[model samples]
Target: MTSTRSVAACVLSTGMAALLWATGLASPASAVQAVIVVGTPSATCANPQHPTIQDGVDAADAGDTIRVCPGTYNEAVNVTKSLVFRGAQAGVDARSGRTNPARESVVQPPGASTGFTVASGVSNVTIDGFTIQDSEADGINTLSAGSGFTISNNIVTGNRIGINFRSPGTTSTDSRIRRNRIVDNNNSLPAGGSGVFLGGGQGTDNLSITQNRFGGHVNADVNTQGVLGGGDPAEALTIASNTSVDSATFLVLINANNPRVQSNRISKGPAEPSGSAMLVDANTDGAQILGNQITGGQGTGIRVAALFGPDPSTNMRVTRNTIRSRTDGVLVEALDSGTFSSNIVENSTANGIQVDPAVAPVTPLLFSSNISRFNAVWDARDQTSGGGTAGTANTWRGNVCPKDSPDGICR
Candidate 1:
C-alpha cells in the first residue's frame, strides 16, 4: 500500500514548535502570539461574535490550539491543520444535543451528526479533556497519517470505538495512546467494540499504547477484536504499560510483526469461562512479550501461533513476566527459534510452558532461567514439545521449583 501524507503528520512538525512557543521556552516568531480560543455564543472566544472550532483550526498554521468550550456539540470536527484541540473544562460531551442555548448554548448545527472527525493528515494533534461519546463510527476517528498525537485525558464512552486510527497506508509513526479512560464502546457491534484501536491496513509504525485503562468486551471473529487492531504486518508496534480488564478475547491481538507487549496488567474472563489473554496469530514474528502480568483468562496468557500452516516464528523473546490463573504462562509453538527466559508462571491449571508439537517438528525451544513455582500443575510439561527427545532439547536450567524457589510457597 502506497502511503499518503495525513493532516496529522503535517501538523505534528509544526506542533512541536508551537509547544515550545506556548511554554515560553523559545521564540520562533519575533513576538509571542497570544493563545487563540474559538467557538460561538460565548464572550471568552477570540471572536466572541464569530467563533467556530473549525474556524480556529482553519486559522491555525502548524503550531496552534483550538480551544473548545464545555457542552454537547453535535458536530464532526475535521482538522486539516496541525494544532491542539483542548477543552476549557472537562466533561465536554461532543456527541449530540446542544447545551441549553440560553445558559450555555453548546455548538450544534441543525443536522450535525458525528462527534469528531480528524482528517487531512494532521499530525501531532492532541484532543484532550472531554467526555466524547455516541458518535457514528468512532468518537474520535483519526484517518490521517500523522504522528506524535496524544488522545489523552478524556472519558470516551458509549461509542463504536473510543479512538480509531484509520491511517492505513501512511507512514504515521511515533503516536502515543495514553491516559484515556475508555469504556463501554460496544455500541455498534453486538459483542462490543475495542476501547482503542491503532492502525488499519494502511501501515502504521512505531505506535505506543501506554498507561491507559481499556475495558469493555471485544468479540472475536475470523478477525477484529482486542484493544489494538490487527495492524499492518509491515510496521513495528508497541503495546505496553496498559491495563486491560474484562475483555472477551485476546487483550491485544498482534497480526503485525515485530510488536512488543510489555509490562501491561491484563485480566479477563474467569478461568471456568476460558478467554485467551493475548493471541498472536498468523504470519507474526520478532515479537517481545516482557514483564506483563496476566490473570483469570481461560487460555494461554500469551499465545504465539501462525495463521497459516507452514510458516514459523523466528528471533523472538518472551521474558521476565508474571502469568497467573488456569491458563498457561507462556505457550510457544511452531516457532523456528526463540527464547523464553526468566518468566514467573504460577497458579496455572495447565503446564507452565506449553510447546506444541503440532506446529513445528521439535528442535530446541529455549526454556531457561524461568521460575515456575506454585502452579497448580506441573512446572513444565514436555508433552507438546516432542514425546521425549524434543523435550530434552529444551534447556530447563536455573528453574526453581515451587518448594525451592525464592517465593517458595507453592499452590
Candidate 2:
C-alpha cells in the first residue's frame, strides 16, 4: 500500500543527497539535484519543487524548500527561484474557495485565478500556509524585478487579480507584500478584475502593502489601477490594515506616487450593486490620506479625481478619514494642492465635499478639522470653487454640524 508515488520514489532515491545537504539546495558537485515529492510526508526537503505543486516550482533551486503535505494539490504555481513554499495546512493551497454539491475537492471554480507567478529576476521568496483558490489571473503575480519577498499565511480566493506587483522590464524594487487573506477576488472577468493589482513596466518602488483582508465576497475591484500607465515613478506606497466588503472599485490611483493610505475598512455587501467606493483617479500625486474607514457604500464614498490621463502633479495630505454611506461622502474634484484635516462626515446621500471645476486664481483648497454630520444633502458643495457656488473658497475652519447654523453651511 505504498503508493503516494511509491512513497515519493522511496524518498527520492534515499534522502536525495541528504536532503541536498540539509537545505542549501546542493552544490556538492551537482548530482543534477532532483527530488520532487508531495503529500503523505515522511518528512523531507532538498531540491524539491515539482512533484506537482506546480511542478515543484518548476524544478526548484536557489535555496529551495518546497515541502508540502496534507492532500489537495491542483496545479498552477510558478515561483522562478529563491524559493521556500510550505503549505500543508493554512488553507490547503489547492484553491479551496468552497463549492459543494458533489464537487468534492472542487478542482477549480470559486474565484478561479491560479497562484504564484513571481517572475522577472526572482529574489528571496517565501510563500507560506496555502489556501489559494480558482485563480484565472491573480492569486499571486509579482512580476518583473522580484525583490525580497514574503507572502504570509495565505488564503487568497476566486480571482481576477489578488497580489500583482509588476515591473517586467525596468524598475521593481523593495518588496514585502504582507500577511495574506484576500478573499473572493474581483472575479467579474475583464482580465480577471483586481484584488491587488500593481502593474509592472514603470519602476515599481518600495512597496509594503500590509495586513491584508480585502473585501468579503468581492464581486470586482479591491485594489488596482494604482499607477500602470507609464514607466518609472510609482514610489513609496504603504497601504495598511486592509478590509473591504463588496468592493467594485475600492482604490484606484492612476499614475500614483508617494502614497500611504491607512487603516482601511471599506464597506458594501449585503448583495452589492452600488458602485464607486474610493476612486482617487487622474495623475494622483504625493498622497498621505490617513486613518481610513469608509462605510456602507451604495456609490461614491471618497472620490478625488483629476488629470484625465496624461501626467499631472500636485500635493495632498488628507487626514483622519471616516466617511459614511448612501453616496458622496467625500468627492473633492480636481486639484493643485490639498490639506484637509480630521475628517469624519456621516450619512451622506450626496455632498460632503463635492468641489469640482477649479483651475483659477490658484485657490487650490485647504480645509481644516472637518466634521460634517447626518447629511441628507449639501454639507459642502462647489460646482466650481463658488462660481457655480454651493460653498466658496471652502474654509469652514474647525468645523462641526449639529445641522449647521454657525455658518458651517448646510441645514
Candidate 3:
C-alpha cells in the first residue's frame, strides 16, 4: 500500500489548498504549504503523522500549518519558524461550556518550563485555541525581534504569567492578542507576575490587546513597561474592550506613549496598595482613557501619577467613564496637562475626584463637565497649592457636584 504522508500531500495538492486558504490556514502566496497533523486522525485533520506537537513543528517548513487534535500535550513547544499552529477548537470560547476533552487541545508544560516559546526573529506566527497551563513560567512567551504574532482564543491559567512579550534590544511590533481567557496566572506572587506582561528591556510598538477576559492575578491584569532607563517608549499600544476582575490591578501603563485604553469593564480590584483599576504612571504621555465602566473597587477607580521619576504623567484625556469605588473614584498625583471631562464618579468612600496636594503645583489640568456626587469627602477636591481657584492653575469649570474643596468649584 501507499504511504499516508504521500497520500496526504497528493490530496492537498488537488483541492485541499483551496479549503486551507478559505479557512485562513494558508494564504494565497503560500497556497501549497503542507498541513502537518498531530495526534490521531480525525475528520478535520486526516492522515495524522506526528505523535507530538514538537515533532510536527520540527517537520514543518516555514508557513506550513500544524493542526493539533484534541489531546493533552505535556511538553514545551518551541517555535523557531513562522507557521500557524491551530488547535482543534480555534476561536471557540472555552468558558462557554463547549470545551470537552474530546475536542480540547491542552498543553501542560512539565516542570518550570513554558508551554510555548516563539523564538527570537520568528515573525508571522499564530498560536490559536489551546488550554496552556500549570507552568511555573509563562504559558506563552515571545522573545525579541518578532512581529505579526496573533495569539487568540485559548484558556491560559495556573502559570506564572499567561502571555509575555519580551523585547530586550530591538522592538516587536504589530502583534494582536485577542479573545482569550487568561485567569489565575499569578502563581508566582511577591516575586512579580501578570496576566499579560509586555516588558523586558525595550517596549513594543502598535501592540493591540483587546476583547479578553482576565481575573485572579497577583499583579496587574495587563501591564506594560518601557525601556528601563527610558530609551524608547511603548508606542501606540491599545488595550480595549476587555473585562478584568479580582486582579491586584486591572491595567498599568508605565513609560508608555500614546496608549489608548477604552471601553473596558473592570471590577473588584484587590484592597492592596497596587489595586487600582487603572494606573497611568511614570513617563506615560498622551494616554486616552475613555468610556470604561469601573465598579466596587476598594482601591481608586483610576489613578494618574508620576511615582517613579520627575517626568509627570502628561497630556492624558480621561472622559466619559462611569466610576464607582470604595475609595476615590479618580485620583491624580504629579499629573500635568490633562483633561478629566464628562465623567460620572459616584458612591466613593473618599473624594469623588481628587488632585493630591502632596504633588504640589499640579498645574494646567482641566476638569470640565463632570458629574461627581455621593462621595464621603468633597465631591471634587483639588488640593494642589494653586488649585481650586478660577485662574490659579487647575481649572474646574461647568462641573455638577454636591460639594467641592473651594466654594466656587461646584456649579
Between candidates 1 and 2, name the one with more favorable lDDT: 2
CA lDDT, every model vs. true structure: 0.61, 0.62, 0.81
Predicted model with the maximum lDDT:
3
The alpha-carbon RMSD values of the candidates against the true structure, listed in the order shown, are 9.2, 15.1, 5.3
lDDT of 3 by residue, 1-411 (tens): 111332223346757888788888984543457678888666755667888899988888898888898888999999989999999888786544544666778899998899999987888899899889989888999855588889998888999888987543335447888889898997766544588988666777768889999888878888874244446678878899999878878887888788999999988843544478898887888899999999886788899887665688778899999998658899988777889999999999889998887654445788899999999988998776563464346888899998887677779
> How do all the candidates rank in terms of lDDT, highest first?
3, 2, 1
Give the winner by TM-score: 1 or 2: 1
> Which candidate leads in TM-score?
3
Over the stretch 1-411, how does candidate 2's per-residue lDDT look in tens digits? 211221223234557878877899866453233324444333333333244665565555566566665445666666677777766543333223423322121123223445677766787787777666676766777766666677766767676676776643234446665566676665656566566777654545667767766664443444536455644556777777777667665677666676778888777853576666766655667788788888876777777765446444457777889888657787775666667778888888866666665533244466677887777877665554442123465455666655542244332
Ranking by TM-score: 3, 1, 2
Model 1, 44-101: lDDT tens digits are 4444312556666656666665566655566666777667777754334322332333
How high is each candidate's TM-score?
0.73, 0.38, 0.88
How well does model 1 score by local distance difference test?
Answer: 0.61
Clashes of each: 19, 23, 0
Between 2 and 3, whose lDDT is larger? 3
After the best TM-score superposition of candidate 1, give how far the Cα of residue 271 lies from its true spot, in angstroms.
8.7
